[model samples]
Target: MTSPQLENHLPFLRKTGGAWELIVDNKPYLILGAELHNSSMSSARHMESVWGKLRAMNINTVLGNVTWEDIERDEGVFDFTELDRVLVAARSSGLRMILLWFGSFKNGSSSYVPGWVKTNTRRFPRAQIRDEHGSLTLSDSISIFHSECVMADIKAFTELQRHLANFDRQRTVLMVQVQNEVGLLGDSRDRSLQAKKQFNSAVPNDLVRFLSSQFNNLQEDAKEKLGRFQDTLSLCHPSDQRSWEDWFGSSVYTDELFMAYHYATYVESIAAAGKRAYDIPLFTNAWLPKPAVGGGLGNLIAAGGALPGSYPSGGPISNVIDIWHWLAPSLDFVAPDIYDADYTATCDTYKRGGRPLFIPEQRRDAHGARRLWEAIGSHLALGACPFGVDSLEPESFAYTAQYKLLGSLETLILRSRQDSKRTFGFYFDEFEGQQADKGPPIGVSFKEFDLLISRAFVFGRPSPGCGMIIEIHVGRYLIIGDGFKVEFKSRSATSTFTGILRAEEKSVQNTVTGALRTERVLNGDETRSGKWVNMPSENPDYGDGFIPLLTPAGTRIVEAQVYSIDE
Candidate 1:
């Protein structure tokens, strides 16, 4: 038999990449994504229009939710005809899918469950909370204890995965987000008799083991205590507090701890099922805060019950939910579903995990648009996906995307820029913005930085003849613009400083826009001058520049790169 044909695959987003950069065809691939509902248009023809919009925007991944309400409206019965049409349309449009198996919980609600389960008060149970009238209400509509954990939901979802494996396995649809935002949303950890019994049982060996390894030589009281506190490891805090009270203070600690545990269990289980059927990489997306706390947004109160409420004027837990590092060890990668502004801080928080980050969902704001570029060259982000790529207005879509993300990603597409490229990592440098001398030269020693906004203003006003001074280490960092100069010392070649070997200058530009030229100064007069670079490049067209003269204590950059300066 002939070998099976594979379409453009996003193998990087799958299970094997783990915490590192996602590699596709032996290279790390970045995914610019947007999440879409199962049927925004409720028909295949509409999907074609949506896909065209996504392609024009250059979005690479689509997070599509496959709902239980549509698949299994009746128990022991299933329907996938509509979902099949959506997947086929998505594949034809050349966009990959991070399929959300909307099996049980979506933002802590059972609204999507089958009618039989939702209406029945007996077989499928509900979470209980003390209502204002001294009666109990459902903790959340979707519960593993009540609605979702059923074999009914699992079988149908598993079947959905099987269908995708058979049909679109080798196409633009590559990975699956087993579930959407899996977490416990209650006034407290479930207190119902059924939930309490399961909660009281000796904590699972796996978690106990992981916890034991994390805090070795600590008291057993600590282990037992964390279990009692349940949600945020309250055992580490004051002894007098109740688990629910943990909700009121430093909400991140509790929200994140609870989310990480709950989400991990759900993802691992769902991933196991999907892997058994199709062995693809699976992930989950966290609905994050605009100025969120590190753990998770703590505002989801559904039908007067607790759920993941990080959206819509959420309460206390905003700041604490932003900590990506605290939850790093648990999931494949934690994605921030961002909405609102200040894109820089949001992306920065995610990267703190030290794992290669993927912006699975982002705000519709223009600042968020520019940030995609900033993230690519500045932080070495693996992928960036805008939210709702399918629904974006037609007018400025291409203009925003083609330059916003596609421009920077060009380095990874070509055979030459592939291996030579390096992530800029953390830095202390400066540059010019959008005005005359508006762009300025910036420099940073391992200890300090050189910032010269513009020499243009000191003598005259900036005008039509423009210039730029940017300092960066990614996607061909060019310190000066077309008619400028720049110079800096080479790091190290063979475990020692490679002294200044005369600076050479070369202006390189995209084959298309020779007007947008770049000048590189590998080495120059600034080397070993006590300060790496004191005077900015005197070259008129090159703009400003930066030179780093690392101190003796700093580890020499392991390789000696050739030095140059040319026009």
Candidate 2:
């Protein structure tokens, strides 16, 4: 007989057929999460003032850093005094937490390491990067090759997880990020004497075997990097010795791949130790590649320079993401810390190989807030967190209105996402003049009709817009957010016309029961005389310069039913 349908577990990802949902407290939970400023959580008093502000903005979860230096200042002495206070404050404020471990590396630096570790460079050696003159200079990042450094990090992380498991029976802490934006910054790969020796040695037989066997199935980026060298494993004997330069071309990218192996191994070891202690889901975030400054198509360099050190070498970038996935089996998923890059492309890149999309860090502005809808609606992201959220006031923050609405309708959104094709998220930025530059209107299909959604009709110039749509059933849909409109057209040729039958403004009457009540019936001016449904911008110019007053849409949530007229 089949096993019974499972209920929720403590912060685990549950796969439903093809789609995945984060199960928390016996229900599918959507994290309307915000990440605090990097240094905000260092003090208990600072967190005390921020909790109420976060709740006011309707953020259900907050991602904050838990530094290794602060937790274990004097060698083996682990202290949870400050962390305990932060956790208690979060619990009292009714917010879930995802703690980020700032250890060994944060943006490719060992700045967060304990005072003892920093002082003794011999015991915990720093990574050395080569300069143009071929001389090696020390970077702030710890060397992954150092066993002492790895052991120290592993001990501190294991202790933190153990403490969390015992103290948080309520499981207010949902997930733990292993480290913050880890990788060598100055150079792509470490150029220290020890690193050079390792690089010259034969590539690990296990990695070679895995790469050769899975060559065809690898992600596009990884496949491109491995190129013809991948055939070496199949053509040559396993005992054959092939140095890094022999296996792959002597390029900066090759250096990155080499570093990826070591970094993944180091992170995997730490994550594995933590899992053994507490076994909660663990993830690591990446500082995504910036589009090559002037490099066209194939010549693209993600982090400015052509060498490994230019970007955080060895981080989970697209070129070597597969290596990390294969080597770092202990990590639940790899996330992107997206800022300034092409938003949609970065999201798509991280979601490769059926991995869940989770944005741990992103721009915390209107442009960024608007994109969260797309991340959740289109990508099925577990969460999208805006960086440096503590600095913004609730009333002034761009996410305030959007997050509040999503927070209330989260259950419905989560339920709809199970059927991937039925739900979608979108956003329209302020007009950039060239309409042709903007892509085609978004299209959605129901049995007998298709909906074409575009920027809401404006008498004057259009404004920025963002929102999501869910098809409840054929001919009926739920829409949320503002600054957009949807037009329906009959899919069947036999049907000559299509029109909105009814549009009702909806409000969540009871969140527990998922009961919605109609606050207003929209038609005529509201629905543009049944021509289309409008969810206007929260603040719009009245198109009457004479009147000079902002005309608001008044309501953003709507349920619309459409019908096709047979020819």
Using lDDT as the measure, the top candidate is: 2
lDDT per residue for candidate 2 within 1-567, as digits (tens), equals 421223224677777755677777767888899998889999999888899999999999999999999999998899999999999999989999999999888887889999999989899888887665667788777888879999999999999999997888788998999998888876768888789999999988887777777878777877887785766655777567798888877877788888999999999999999989877789999877665543121222234443456667889877788888999989989998887778898888888778888999888898899899999888889989898989989998989888888877887887776655477799987656666525347887766678888887767666778888888888898988888889999898899888999999999987766678999998877788899888888666556455433336765889999998896
Candidate 1 lDDT, tens digit per residue, 336-438? 5555534566666555535455666665545355455456545556555665556566456532433332434343322222433333222112234643343
- Per-candidate TM vs. native? 0.63, 0.93
Model 2, position 66, has a per-residue lDDT of: 97
Clashes of each: 43, 6
Each model's lDDT comes to: 0.46, 0.83
lDDT of 2: 0.83
Top candidate (TM-score):
2
**In terms of TM-score, how similar is model 2 to the real structure?**
0.93
Question: Which lDDT value does model 1 have at 160?
Answer: 73
